[model samples]
Target: MDVAGIARIATEMTDFSTKEAVGIAVLKKAIDINAAGALALIEVIPDNSQSAPNLPLNLGRNINTIA
Candidate 1:
């Protein structure tokens, strides 16, 4: 192939590589943001386990299904 054709192909390949890199970087950022948000949400959930300590320990241990 001529020099011009080779140059064009190289330029196209470079552009494709750059676009792919940018896409991957953006996806990583989005995933990081989502993970941070999920952790924040999880942290805010009230700890109900300690709040009901007054109930009997065996209250929920067994189920009576003979009724």
Candidate 2:
């Protein structure tokens, strides 16, 4: 997939903030390096069909926000 597709999938799969989203978009596309930063942290939440490991308490705060 292209950068846009990757960004979209990342967006849908995680609950990243606006700044984080832009940073991820920029990184994935390499169209803009200005937005890259540590704020782009990601949290993955697996669906019923998928198996996911339990994240540490500090990392699982944004789990299962998707509909």
Encode model 1's per-residue lDDT on 1-67: one tens digit a residue.
9999999999999999999999999999999999999999999986656757888766666899999
Q: Which stretches of candidate 2 lie over 4 Å from their true place?
A: 1-16, 31-67
Ten-residue region with minimum lDDT total, candidate 2: 34-43
> Which whole-number lDDT from 0 to 100 does residue 43 have in model 1?
94
TM-score of every candidate relative to the true structure: 0.73, 0.22
Q: Which stretches of candidate 1 lie over 4 Å from their true place?
A: 51-67
C-alpha-based local distance difference test score of model 2: 0.62
Top of the candidates by lDDT: 1
- What lDDT, from 0 to 1, does candidate 1 have? 0.91
lDDT of each: 0.91, 0.62
**Candidate 2 structure quality by residue, lDDT tens digits, 1-67:** 8999999989876765777888887777774443443234333434434454464444545678688
